[model samples]
Target: ENNKHVNDTENTLKRQKTNKKGGPKRDEVWEYFIVDDEKNDRHYPATYYHCEKKWQKGKLRTLKAHLSNECLQCPENISKFWRDKLSTELTNYTRKQKTIIQLPLKQYQITQHFSSDKPLPLAITERIDRSLLKAW
Candidate 1:
């Protein structure tokens, strides 16, 4: 039936939108995280990443940690790109003067006390900072 054909076409289009080259396309601005490297046969299981800007080559595990902790120290071009983007977004948000809801002073103090009992991990803190920067 024509209706069945239409349904199949729509489904194909939806799948195409979600997938590219057999992998789902990531929506995030940064895609530096390492996946399995399929290029070189010699390093089948070993991980690696190439930094074109600095002409530096590194292993995936080490590079992932370094990128997460010291994104600002990445190759100059990449670092500058992120810095400019964040700065512009922050400047625009500050200029807007949007009203942010605030917790009462007493409630904030109590919450702080509970939070102080357990420190957040460095990775978690870094993730939170990145989320905020992206949101801004």
Candidate 2:
């Protein structure tokens, strides 16, 4: 029937939208994160996210949605690329991201009360300066 054909066409279009070939996929939204490196260098993750204050406050059961980094740049979307191109591009990103030396990811938990909209506190800056002076 014509209706059946139309339905099939619609489904195909939906699936094709996410396929990584010759077109943009709308399924996954990209997120970038600024992860801290071992030597105080900052490396960004493809998707960066953390627990939200509301989640901690018990008002919300889940953390906030993932947010992209301000400076984190996303690589070009290479939809439907062949295996060889995919491998080469991946290797390039890995190689380019390497610093003087590769550093292990350090995971630490801190009880900092911060909201996404709030800026860093003055006291924190002062403390950082004081700590640096002490090191000097």
Instruction: Please give the range of 10 consecutive residues that has the lowest summed lDDT in model 1.
Output: 46-55
RMSD of 2: 23.3
Which candidate gets the maximum TM-score versus the true structure? 1
Writing each residue's lDDT as its tens digit, candidate 2 over 36-65 gives 212322211222222211111211101112
What's the count of clashing pairs in each model shown? Answer: 0, 3
| Candidate 1 wrongly placed segments (more than 4 Å) | 1-28, 35-69, 94-136
Q: TM-score for all predictions?
A: 0.26, 0.16
- Once model 2 is optimally superposed onto the true structure by TM-score, how far is the C-alpha of residue 76 displaced, in angstroms? 41
